[model samples]
Target chain A: MNRRQSKVLRTLARLVIRLWQMRRVLLLVVPYLFLFGWLFAAGSRMDVRPGELYGVTDEPAWGSPDADHWFGTTVNGADLFELSRLAMATSVSVAVVSVSFGIALALLVTMLFVFDPGEKRFELPNVVGQSGFLLPSFVVLLVLTGGSGGSLGVAILGLILVIAFHLCPVLTTWFQEGEDGFDIVAGYALGLSRREIVMNRILPKILRRLVGVFATYVPVVVLVEMALSFLGFTGDRLSCGAMIAYGQGLIIEAPWMAIYPGLMATAVVLVLSLLGWRVSSAMRTGPLPRLF
Target chain B: MARIVLQRLLVSVIRFAAAGLALIVLIELAFCVIGGSDRHVWRAESYGPVPPGLSARPVSWAGLLEDRVRVSLPVLFICVPGILLIGYSWGILGARLRRFHGARLLAAPFSLFACVPGFWFVVLVAIYSYFHWKRPGFADDLIVEQGPDLLTWWHAAVVALPALAAGAASQIRAVSSVLEREVTRPYLRGLFMAGYSEEDIFYRHAFRRALPALFAAGDRTFSALAGSIVCLEYAFRYPGIGSLLVEAVRLGSYGGILVSAFVLAAFVSAGVIFCESASRLIKPEAAGG
Candidate 1:
């Protein structure tokens, strides 16, 4: 083969080898993907009415798992399986939005800090920002969203903002460490502007590290969102946490109602966590150390 | 020595002042944004109960601060002992358990336990206890109602166990890694060849080297505990700073939220400083390393 074809073949081989190495994680994640797909496809076909299943006077309460109600029925007469699907969808959506917003804001703030290192001298903001995470996130959400009376969209936005704010200090610390290790003197010698060096050289070099950090943090955001939803702070949203909370009272009579949702939530977190662990481990074996 | 202590104290005081100011500014900013008003008005209003025209901001601030301080005392009482108990026991137990077969078998579930949310455990226990209390011929003495009281040590222990398990899992991993690294060092082989007993080498020499990492793990575990304390306190409906902050937030009480934030920050800072100091006392050379 010619040189270009040979190089392309080599790259494709490397990709295949890498994918083979990640087969275990991929296998672990397949069930979640299948569940998500099934939920998506079956969601529209399933009746959306809660009263049709359980709210009626004659309807059985705390039904066991069966063909009619696969996951069982909640004490409040809601279908556990359907509620779990909805909750999982809502939670995954919130987690995606929150993590995305957090990472984006972290990148922006990290870039800002890189351009102006003057803020480093004032450690107060870092401390204060960290305290945001230390404080109960539900409180922050409640305060920001004005006692959770807002729409689901607004609640999600509030969660995104708070999570992003909490993650800023952590991301900034990682990014700062990366910048510190960069050859800034050499960049200057190369006659690159500050923005050019940061955008092109520093950022590109640290992109994998940022991804590792982002993966490590996604599980945290998911847990935080779950906690907030469990506390009824997410404002009437159907979340795994809310499902678990609602099922807590009937845990003895109908344990499936709680266990299924808990397992689903745990599955999501475990998958994201393993993905993070894989990414971080790969980065560790690669050129960079694990940022998180 | 006295000068060093004085300097450290001074630095801590300054740090606390800065943190307090930063917390106030953050609260003011939050209030302004949420209330959709001018920053200056929020700033003045946050100083508290001053009727907007009073020159004595300090007095009102101090009075408000005292109330918050009072509110935070119980949180400190509950969280301090709870964290210390969980951190020390779990850290030491986890490290020691890494050697045992039975404990090794638990490694997977313990690691998975770290992934589970603390509130889920709390709810499950609550439900279990409720059923147990309702059991026929169950003793009245066994039916202890878990509440948000300061004396509810058992309640704290139960609620804190999941966080503790999570912390212990990470601690076990950290300790094992450190031990693995230590085992591969040349000095370990040298000690083995020098006629030192295996237990002596592992427990005396290697353990000393592992202490710093173990302490660092403990620090991380404490921080995790602090994070989980918020959820635990809230889930158990504990009257700690966490639940108070939640209540304040729900009521849109800016001053209460600010005060709780400040207290929580101070508590964390103090815990970190204390951990550093203890670590230094244990291994002075490993303070910053």
Candidate 2:
């Protein structure tokens, strides 16, 4: 088929698959949405005025539960429910950005490792980039958070870089595995250039692994971001981890402060893990042939 | 045959124990130099004057060991047994056991982290024991005092080391199982039936077959540990090399940064050594003279 025709067919196939998967995920999401909505509507209104946190202790806004604040009021008296929503959105964005960058970097690096194993010059640069893996993200985040910008983009970029660095090995391995089929060897034997072979052939197989990897890493992304935010490295106003750390001191007066956010974060992670498993299962042609 | 099997088992245990002990000592020494003092012994002794012998020792090895035993024993005794029981139960339940190749590999380290919940359980027991043993009217408050810097770093190392060791042990088991599966494939079976067995089959045939991929797996495991360790250390406030590195970051302490970098580099080097050693065992011919 011509390039245009192939692209159209690919788009159609992807749309069908996405819609089918979305239906399942949406089924799972509906109950969560209902729970969140009911809780927010039924919960007390928060006074999370701009530049104000909940309680007197500079804790997060979800620090107390009462008739005035069902989820409880933070030390600053901000509604716990609303702040939970914001934390949820921030976490979802972090998960998306981190997983996207991680998968992309993994694909690129793995392709480099697979088709061009001994070409040291290019791979050397890749290794140097990977040396950043050992540098704790907190250090970089501290340096960055110390700077002026606290934009959402900066936080996303930070989270993505951390997740991507962690993902390098997995991406590389999956790429190597998917690239090792008879077709790839045949392509090389037939004198297809490395770029042509990787782009036209290896990538298709690698793409199959993307759903699985993306599903797997999303939960980890959420956890790492929570950690980063907890460490005060996120630079944003609030994060799931930051909320947990900040709210712990008020665990007694406002148990909901910890309970609500912690439950949200945990649920999101569990969902991502289950989704990852589903994606892996869905991609199965059969029992996977072992690769040596 | 039984005697030979027993000998190999003894050798492997000795080797594993030696590596584990060497790791503990080396990490403690590194924490000592970083913490910059050595007054405490057995626990953080903030109120006391320094003993002359401890001050004069090569690396505060005894103080470090006491701290390690004090902190680590409770945590490990609780976590190791608990996880073994849970993992054992899961193993029994069959389907509930993680079967995904990647998930299984990830879980070894993840479960090690997950076992931190066991620390709280340990602390409760310790508190109960203290009361049971006739409390000397100790402070039972949750907010434990942070005392002198003397060997706080060592104490952190001692606290962190067991978890790291456990994490490494699980990863090795997971990766080796994956490697074994990879090496014992049908194609490898073909090479085996072609008049190879045992050493020849593993080294000459299987090892050659799996080298690139094994390195690939090593890279992945190493990277995953890198991300997880920092969070784990920070959560426990374990003043390991990673935690020191993080504090250096938070305070922008350049000395802490250097130490952290040096220690992290050492770990990466150790990982490389681990890979090389594993390769040698799997395929001796690969390191052919």
Candidate 3:
């Protein structure tokens, strides 16, 4: 083949790769938007104040699904559709808070490794974190509650504490990965402190490589919040898990209640993970070389 | 080489065992502090005796522990082999499918499954049982005619299905990555040209080289499963340690927490040490990296 033929074929292949990446990004955005959407209606806020979404009503209870009630009414005469929206919002907000808090805690703890000798670095995070797997997060939360749950704010704070403790070791281990490149060796040879070499030379590279990985954990935090709620460990919070818990009870009467939130959680978990992988791949693929 | 690996394994066993013991003591002390007790709390903090909390009645830690072992051990046994076999098969499948739509088709679903949290699996299984069996909830006495430990575990094993899927999904990715790197090595091409049979090239070479990584995946999958035991037991009410934890927590029994945490922690420590040793022992040098 002539140079022109080879060049054309290469360009076509590059085009195909770009299209695939673009499709992945769009796929990620769609589910993300759905999670944040007020699927019941944009008019949910107009119908009742956000505060009233949680309150019981004297209106007809257990009403069937109709144009006005997308998910219908609960046994308490509360709007199931509006309550569902609130549950999702609570779940997302708590997830965002807990994940950010967890990462921050992880970073703080990982920074300590910079001061430690290299041999300890290998053993400390690996063995210590592995053993931590034995201690259940639910048990910790229950312990903190002293049997009965407290306020939602306190429960969220407790949730954040539990999540951060569990998450820190995982993040630290991931951050500690990677071979010592020439730059790191040079930094060490030049008599830089372990902290300086790691902070200045190594961390930036690891962060860049794992940036997409961080988003993948959001769905888990959401699900955990729901699980705790379902188990009645989250005090009075009505998150997605709580909604599932509620719907599970009324299954014979209102199967849609449980089904909708369960479907939403499933969608979020599936899509977010796919997005994370794509993002990781895209990062690895990193701007392909320009076609001649 | 064997001696060195054995020594390292022994050292690891000693190290993690010591750590687990120390952590168990620390957890017991910590709970004592939280529940507000005297030195007697520490004195009476023996396994199998589950020193009664402020109000909870004394329950035999041995029986509860036996329940946990019966359910969780089978899950672990079932899950580890499932991960290894499925991961190994899928990795081998990749080499054949490499020329066509393999990466997209094989990878995407596994990637999704791999990231699914363990509780989600419990929830999925719970949801399925709810729909299929028309059961409102899972409880120990819910079935009065419980059978032998082995038979009872099969009932509990209903929840292990999703866990196996998640674990196997993660392991598949690990095996595939290692296989891809191993098969593409320049030395492998030279062997291809030197008249080595494809079977020998794969099983005797690439597969052996992949053993350490496969063991590492197993180790990780085990740890992940250990973390999920509480959720699994809690959801299924399988008379495991997790159910014990729920009972303890509901009744505010610190002794219950103490025993349950100790058992699970011991299991994890033992598992981690075993897996880590095996992974390192089969270094590509021994297996031929």
Q: How high is the lDDT of residue B66 in model 2?
A: 42
List, residue by residue over A83-128, the lDDT tens digit for candidate 1: 7767666666667677678678766765555776464632654756
lDDT of 2 by residue, B15-80 (tens): 344433333333333233323335221243422332332223433434533442344334334433
TM-score rank order: 3, 1, 2
Give candidate 1 misplaced runs (Cα > 4 Å).
Answer: A1-62, A74-78, A115-142, A146-202, A248-260, A287-292, B1-32, B35-110, B135-151, B169-224, B254-259, B279-289
Candidate with better lDDT, 2 vs 3: 3
TM-score for each predicted model, relative to the true structure:
0.69, 0.59, 0.74
Question: Would you give me the overall lDDT of model 3?
Answer: 0.60
- Top candidate (lDDT): 3
Better of 2 and 3 by DockQ: 3
Candidate number achieving the greatest TM-score relative to the actual structure: 3
Task: Pick out the ten consecutive residues of candidate 2 chain B with the lowest summed lDDT.
Answer: B115-124
How many clashes does each candidate structure show, in the order listed? Answer: 0, 15, 3
Tell me the lDDT of model 3 at A165.
63
Across residues A4-70, which tens digit of lDDT does each residue of candidate 2 receive? 5588899999999997657754654565466446434533333322224533454444434667765
Which sections of candidate 3 miss by over 4 Å? A1-60, A64-70, A115-123, A134-179, A182-201, A288-292, B1-59, B71-77, B91-154, B181-203
Q: What is the interface RMSD of candidate 2, in Å?
A: 11.1
Instruction: Compose the digit string of candidate 1's lDDT tens values, residues B57-87.
Output: 4446456456535544544555456545554
- Model number with the top DockQ: 1
